[model samples]
Target: MRTKVAIIGAGPSGLLLGQLLHTFGVDNIILERQTPDYVLGRIRAGLLEEGTVSLLDQVGAGARLHQEGLVHHGVELAFGGARHRIDMHAATGKTVTIYGQTEVTLDLMNARKAAGLTSVYSASDVKPHDFDTDHPRVTYVKDGVSHEIACDFIAGCDGFHGVSRASVPASAITSYERVYPFGWLGILSETPPVSPELIYNNHERGFALCTMRSSHRSRYYVQCPLDDHVDQWSDDRFWDELKRRLDQKAADELVTGPSIEKSIAPLRSFVAEPMRFGRMFLAGDASHIVPPTGAKGLNLAASDVHYLSQALREYYDEKSSAGLDGYSARALARVWKAVRFSWWMTSMLHKFPDEGEFAARIQIAELDYLVSSKAASTSLSENYVGLPF
Candidate 1:
């Protein structure tokens, strides 16, 4: 098969890119190693920056999001037994939409199907070949048959552990990473959220986040040892532990329920430099990862797609290679800023194992300053609402 672009993975990045390219009059095919259900089954970040929502609107997939997604103007930071609200909208003139990543994938998937686009799910052994030359193609195995797609360019939207980045020669890519000592033990419950807005708490016990998928379905997380297991945290135990970390007001108002989904995710900050490799380019998790503290994971992917789709459109419409040539540096600039923000939030909100009383006191002081000073609050609010795309 031949196409203008061959995309790897059927996750939000790949699907959104395909939709955007199709809207831009670019022919593209998506290859996925998992089924459609599997892709939508993955629960991910629920926060969407204004820029990300705009991209979805551009692709005509924002109808459901606009109708169902909750918009938050502020976020609360709880520390020292009190909660301080950061007015994100007042400070940045922007707002974030609380919409699950799964819903975004579903909307894009439906849009792709309605447009009769090509997507090969459950394909195995997918690989990109000859990306260093003008001619680049992708190969995969499906239903015990081998296939190859000849395309003008290849897009690696797979993920951090995907074949897209793994295919690259180690010497060609420079990687920087830091794995945190703790992981987040999260649970999804069918209960009303304790607070109308999301609450991020920094307590002597650990870090706990109170977020929701909807008004009735809440998602909560508490920091735990990296080696902790889901079985070790029962529903009652998780609720009890969460309450212990919350302030008196939130603890009193918190509702407990049976957990429908629970898992532990280790925190890490990673980036692979030079997102472009000849005719093939990496976007989204294929190039970088950040701790979820600042809720930048999915938004970063959207920004990468924005830069990439624009580059491809320019290449086709104006026959210009400038955007393509500058894709990596441009995307990395935004990616690094987000990485720094996520790291900073993680550091300020989470209790470190080895960091002694001095470090703890410093964190308290920083949080105190962050809430008391308008400049610091505005900075945090701007970053939280997202920087300009």
Candidate 2:
């Protein structure tokens, strides 16, 4: 089989890119190593930057998103037994949409199916070859049979562990990573959220976040040791710890319920430089990863798709290579800013293992200044809402 572009992985990035290209009359194919259900089963961050929401609108996938998504004009930061709110909308004139990543994937998948686009799922050993040459090809085994796709370009949307980035020689890619000592122990509950807007809290014990997918469904998280397991945390224990971290008023009003889903996620900041390798380019988790503190993972991916899709469109529409040639620099410029913001937020909220009392005091000082100073809050709000694409 042959197409203009071959997209690896069927996650949001791949599907979004495929949908955008198809909408513009660019022929493309998507390949996935897992079944559709497995892909949608993975839970992820839900906060949507303005850029991501707009991109969804452009691709005709915003009907469900705009209808169901909850818009928040501000987020609260709780520290020192007091609650302070960051005016994200007043500071930046932009708000974030509270929509689950799962819903986004479902919408994209449904849109793809309705548009009659092709995607190969449950394919094994999917690999990209000859990306550096004028002609690129992708090969995979499906149902015990081998197949190949010859295309003009390949999109490495397969994610961090996928074959896309691994296909590039190590010498050609420079990587930077930082693995934190703790992870986020999170749960999804069926009860109403403790707060209308999301809350980022710093307590003497650890960091906790109060966020929700909708008015009735809530998602919450607390910092935990890296070795902590789900079995060790019962529903009551999780709720108790969450309340302890929140302010007294919220804690008093907090509603507890059985957890529908529970898991722990490690925090890390990773970036692989030069996202482009000849005809193949990396987007989303394939190239960079940020701790969920600032909720940049999927947003960064959307920004990447923003650049990659535009570049690919220009390549086909105008027969120009300038956009494609500049994809790496443009994407990385924005990626690094998010990296800094996520890192900063993580530092301010999380308790580092090696951080002595002095470091903790300084963290408190920083948070105090951040909430007290208008300029500082504005900076935080702008970064939180998202930098321009």
Superposed by TM-score, candidate 2 places the C-alpha of residue 358 at a distance from the truth, in angstroms, of 0.9
lDDT of each: 0.96, 0.95
Pairs clashing in candidate 1?
none
- The residue pairs in collision within model 2 are none
TM-score of decoy 2: 0.99
lDDT of 2 at 180: 94
lDDT of 2 by residue, 332-380 (tens): 9999999999999999999888888898899889999998999999999
Top candidate when judged by lDDT against the true structure: 1
| lDDT of the structure predicted as candidate 2 | 0.95
Query: Weakest 10 consecutive residues, lDDT, candidate 2?
Result: 351-360
TM-scores vs. true structure, each candidate: 0.99, 0.99
The alpha-carbon lDDT assigned to residue 58 of candidate 1 equals 97
